[model samples]
Target chain A: MKKHPLDDYLRVARMPHIWCPGCGLGLVVNCFLRGLLRSQLNLDKVVIVSGIGCTGRAAGYINLDSFHTTHGRAVPFATGLKVANPELEVVVISGDGDLVAIGGNHLIHAARRNTDLTVLCVNNFVYGMTGGQMGPTTPLTARTTTSRGGSVDRPFNIPHLAAASGAAYVARWTTAHVRRLEKAVTEALLKKGFSLVEIVSPCPTYYGRMNKQVTGLDQMKYFRDNSVIKSGIDPKGVGIEVNGPIVVGKFIDRG
Target chain B: MPEREYLAGEFFLSGDDACAEGAISAGCRFFAGYPITPATEIAERMSERLPEVGGNYIQMEDELGSMAAVLGASWAGTKAMTATSGPGFSLMMENIGLGIMTETPCVVVNIQRGGPSTGLPTLTGQGDMMQARWGSHGPYSIIALSPSSPQELYDLTIRAFNLSEKYRLPVLVMSEAATGHMYEKVVIPPSGEIELLARRKPTVPPEAYLPFAPDTDLVPPMANAGEGYRLHVTGLTHDERGYPAMTVEAQDRLVRRLVDKIERNKADIIALEEDGTGDAEVVICSYGVSARVSQIAVERARGEGIRVGLLRLITVWPFPDDRVRELARQVKAFVVPEINYGQIALEVERCACGLAKVVLVPHMGGRVHAPELILEAVRQAAR
Candidate 1:
């Protein structure tokens, strides 16, 4: 078999990953790998930790010393790895429900302590693993299985929450902007204090089907057309609403 | 910058403080915990001591985070620990289950307080004895130790770490409010004098490494995160390769090994201090502070010309059922005294298996058993 370029970074035997056909997790992972390669981090010294979700499976797929932790616990688990061995670069990759909802306390506390960690939160707007339930990141009025009549609860603006909780670096990007998202990941990896990179990925099977976007391409097109790059904008003003303009950029860089 | 790693002297210390020192002596380099009554002093001591010994101390947001962090640190190739009381211990159950599933080596010190729900934050209770064994929602085995004095707390904390690393599971030091807050002289041995057991590291190269594959001892050698092994660990049921195998065969294989590792090694794991059980008419089975109280009762019963003996359980979880059964045949009745209402007594009754009568001297909590009450029970059992 011909070796793929990213083969060195992935667990080839664990291929045919469980992600759905048009899911944006693969693209986000690709961006992450490129960014990791571009950052020149010693692959041997990097560890990935993930909570329970579709994105959490990334830990098993990655070739690093990865840990698939319990639900909503990736941040604290990664925090442990980082604090115990400060020389190792620990990264937490989890989803919206796993991060901002059940794991909100740990996320805020890690940011408050400015614990050196990079958190990659894949915002898919619904709980894809549990059959499209309404999550903390679901845009208001967006339909999900739990929100068949449309959600009325306010969604958490992740970047704003991180910045308010004392994260030294915070950024938001959609899967459509792979190059920029990859750049953000590289920068977040290199940041000294707590850093957050929110990847707005498409969940075609759950979030997409429940809403009008039936395929990942539809969601990507919407992102491409609607995203407004507003670098240096206050994160509080970057909330996503139903059918609203998607604001994307690095909203905070303390360095 | 080279502060003394071991105190190496005699000092009066509370059980909580002694527990912290014991962990430091045992090479526990990472401490993550949340503050709760009785157990807070352990966290306090670690906060001040960990940095001096070049270790990490993190006060996590809650007990769940604290327990998760401890497991993470353990996988990062460091001996880690956490301390909590009843409420915090309840919060830690989820991650404790994770630690058990992953077979991570760490220490969890539960300074038990009175509780069905925040029952008594500042008082002692042995109520969590059953919880220690059966708390985490699955069929699993656990090792737990009870310390009656500050000195035992110091000695047993190191043993807890050793047992955890040896068996590749979380070991629980189940102390209660009485021992935790009691100040007594505790002797600290030299660093070289204290025996320490590190986790067994894999001998094979990364390509041949099976993360969950057991040696003859049924314990897999551990690899740290930064080591080139690239191990994958998960809480889900997994195969020897450390990949999730979601089948009944895999579940049976994994769960059985996890359980059998401790059960088959019970002789090496269980510890008890027996006195006068050879010809006694009545035997007192006790642990923690209750053991200390039962000693007085035993002596008084002896003064009254009754053949009474004391069985002090140092290792509580793998509850010396074999020893209990053997003694039950020779004794008329078994008197079990604990701070809780008949938790360990139920175990004693089950182990006796109708050979002898089991009497439980239950205390509601906040205090140890009255020596007279236990002595009265012993006197009646002898008659």
Candidate 2:
């Protein structure tokens, strides 16, 4: 039986993963795998850790030494792996809710330590795994299962948070920008300390249905039409808005 | 790799310092911990010492991070340890359960201080004994040790690491604040004299490796993270392949293996020191700091012509049930003195099974029990 090129890098038996239709996690995972392959890292020495979420399932699907840890705990667990075995490369791929909402303290502290880790955070703008609820990166005025009346809560500007907390590299892209997202992930993987690439993914299943009945195609069209690349922009000023241009680019690369 | 010395000659070290040295002797090369009272000295000593010996020491953001890191380091193929006090111990409960579920081998040192929440940080208390057994949510079993002196702290910490390696789970060193801060002469034996047990590594190739499959002894072999074993590890109930199996049958098999591993090895795991039990009517049962106090009280009782003996518990968890049950028939009464209100005393009473009168000499935290109070309890129990 012939194997697919990416088959070596995936858990084929665990195929048919528990993700929803129109979810962007699959595309993000594709980008991540391409980046890993391009980086030419020793696959044996690369470890992936994820907390609880749809993105957290990335660890379970990856054919690597992956840890599906408790909610909000992947950073600390990955920090441990890097500190203990400095020879290995550690990556944390989890959602904004798991990383910044409950696990926010760990994310900031790991950044402050300048720990050698590459974090690929998939921001779907809602808590996708636990039903579409308001998350740390949910855009203001976006409706969700929890925020039935448009959300009054201000969401985290993820890039700004990473840069302010001392990340060595920070970048943002949408799943629609697969080539750029993959390239950015490769760059982040090569960086030495606390690298982050935020992939603003779409969740047509919940976030879309709640907010304007936006389907997967509509979200993809929005990404294609509304995204504006602005490398080296002040991350603090690069916040997302409903029906506005999404500023996406490599904002910080201190290497 | 750099060559390093493992043994340091005899020195007057505190219990905490001795513990750090013991970790080094046991090949523990990774220490991740947060600074807390009583146990902070262990982390301080480790920070100064680990780098010199080609190991790493990290001061984590909190106890939760510390525990998580210890598990991570262990999976990365290093003997890892962390030291904390009451508040930090409480914070580590959630991840401790994770460690148990994943069958990660690491050492957690909880130098006991007074607490339900942050009570008497700089003082001694054994109130965490019950919490150590049932602190983490879910049905699971763990190995815990108590040390009465600085010398024992060194010896037992190495044993703690060995037991964790053997059992493929986290082993706890539950020392009191008094023991942690107390200074005594400790002899660091030559590296050859120390017995270090490495985790059983998988001999089978990556294709045939089952991360959670048990052997005859019911412990699965571990494969290091970078050993070409692209294994999946999760906190959710998992099968032998280490993949999540969300069923009652899967839960039963997984939880039973986790618990049965300890229960089947109870005799080998139980460690105690008994004296004068032969032809004695009154036996004084104690552990940790209370054991030292009870010794003094027992000797005083002997001077007063009472038949008193001491059964000091070195391994606290797994309860020494069979031994306690056996002593119940021979001894007339048992006096259990502890720094807590009455934690281990209840265990003694349950094992005594009404054949012997079990008296508790309780001390509310911040201090050890007075010898006279224990002596009085012994006298009353003897009567």
Candidate 3:
């Protein structure tokens, strides 16, 4: 019957969350909560909107004004909430497949409009919720359920895309870099006008296993070993390659 | 110029403009819409009017985003709406279903144009009647109202908001291109004189609140985003506590309540304008622009002593089945005229249930049905 420190910020009853073992989603949520606490935001005025995917369920676990919206629709839905009540802080947390694939148009348009929102994109490199299919963020040569031999198609460099589409703040961090990821989320939360923090998380049950990482810990180890911290680097040069060094940083910071 | 919250005077307005004014009067503080033909005027007027009244108007990327935005605003405890036509209406179907499943209150105005696929952009079409009822791909009921004139459009736009707030679901204002484009005198009443219904707010404290727990009226009291209540809303089949429940029993309970909230409350939801149907041998059933055309035909048939009458549908969704059935028992035949081939006529046929003959006068869209065509149908039905 021990009370958890974060219980006040979470829906404890809805606990034993639906996330799988060694899933980075929990880590991402932890970082987000830490960032939320650090930002000193009025919890009463924050609303979270998410689209359909494994990451979409994050809305339900948080004890705030949360909306689990339709597929690829969180950005637009959050846009509506923010525009209607400018006093309320709106954040969108959804997976890469939800935000960059079907919702790509909304993502770019929101950034173009410079709407005030913080978007936390959990990029597991594949569609983990619907089985490991090739997604827009899947690195080149990444194997998924659909990409049997290898993903022949080029993947999107999300930070580059966000920055190009007029995002005022764009950054990327992996689940292994929990402290940096938390700090990035905090900065994104406080920043105005279309901020995006891309969390390169692991999907051990699907994407990780398919890519030979075998376990979530292995993926975390890979991220820790391979990711190079490049502050203020150009987003265009930060695209991930197959087993290549990952360049992670805050790429865009414009008012 | 100073901002004016109420235009309390008579002015010439198109149906689309009147609808925007009506929404403003009805306390709709948030509007999100995409520009589409015929219905574009509503969004334009809203964009100009909303900021004047301390409200927000967002021109979303497309109708899908518009609909989604409307739902989001409603959750924030704002009266919200969106307007679109055929192609845009098709794009809104997914979020429309979300509105239904999440029991969110908002209004959608579909100033219908011709379409199997973008059939007519500038011309009139009543082809989206059935689509309004069943377009969202679900087993839930909907509330739809049809207006034949700018005055009715204004009045019903307010009613659409009221009904949506009362039922906690999306309400459709089904206007056609003819009504949308037509200019007519619209009387804008003072703000205090207009009756507006706000969403029911929860009575209990946040600790004891259940987001989907219905009261006696089957509508849960709503709490806005900034309120102390931490609400979790989703489109999935959820329990009364608003947690996703992936069980068959959960789906049945939730779907049934979503449907029965409107079905069981039909008497309060359905509205009809019955004119001269008491002792007529032939009753012409119609709605939207076709209703006005049917009225002229009825007047003509009455002049010719054919004993024809008109039943103008103000609320089209619940279908006024009881009244239609009662009239069917006394009438020899019923003539249904609509811009589309045969949408509401099929409803009439079902309600009539072999008690009377049903005649359908169909038009394929781009233009309203000529009075002569409806008169001809009425004359044949009177025989």
TM-score of chain B of each: 0.99, 0.98, 0.98
Candidate 1 DockQ, CA atoms: 0.87
Instruction: Give lDDT tens digits, candidate 1, residues B1-383.
Output: 46566688999999999999999999999999988998999999999999889999999999999999999999988999999998998888899899989999999999999988989899999999999999989899999999999999999999999999999999999999999999999999877888899889999999999999998878899998999899899998999988988999999999999998999899999999988888998999999999999999999999999999999999998889899999989999999999987899999999999999999999989888899999999988988
What candidate 3 gets wrong by more than 4 Å, as runs, is: B1-3
Q: Tens-digit lDDT track for model 3 on B86-112?
A: 999999999999999999999999999
Highest lDDT against the true fold, candidate:
1
Worst ten in a row by lDDT for model 1 chain B = B1-10
| DockQ per model, Cα | 0.87, 0.83, 0.84
Share of native interface contacts present in candidate 1: 0.82
Q: After superposition, how far is residue B49 of candidate 3 from its true place, in Å?
A: 0.9
Question: Which predicted model would earn the best DockQ?
Answer: 1
Query: lDDT tens digits, residues A1-255, model 3?
Result: 999888888989888999989899999988999999999999999999999999999999998889999999999999888888888899999999999999999999999998999999999999989988999988888888999899998999999999999999999999999999999989999998999999999898998898888999988989999999997988998989876788898889897
Error of 3 at B345 (Å): 1.2
lDDT tens string, model 1, A1-255?
899899988988888899998899999889999999999999899999999999999899898889999999999999999999998999999999999999999999999999999999999999998888999999999999999999999999999999999999999999999999999999999999999999999998988888889998989998999999998999999999976789999999997
> Which stretches of model 1 miss by more than 4 angstroms?
none
Residue A228 miss distance in model 1 (angstroms):
1.0
The count of residue-pair clashes in candidate 2 stands at 0
True-structure RMSD, every candidate? 1.0, 1.5, 1.2
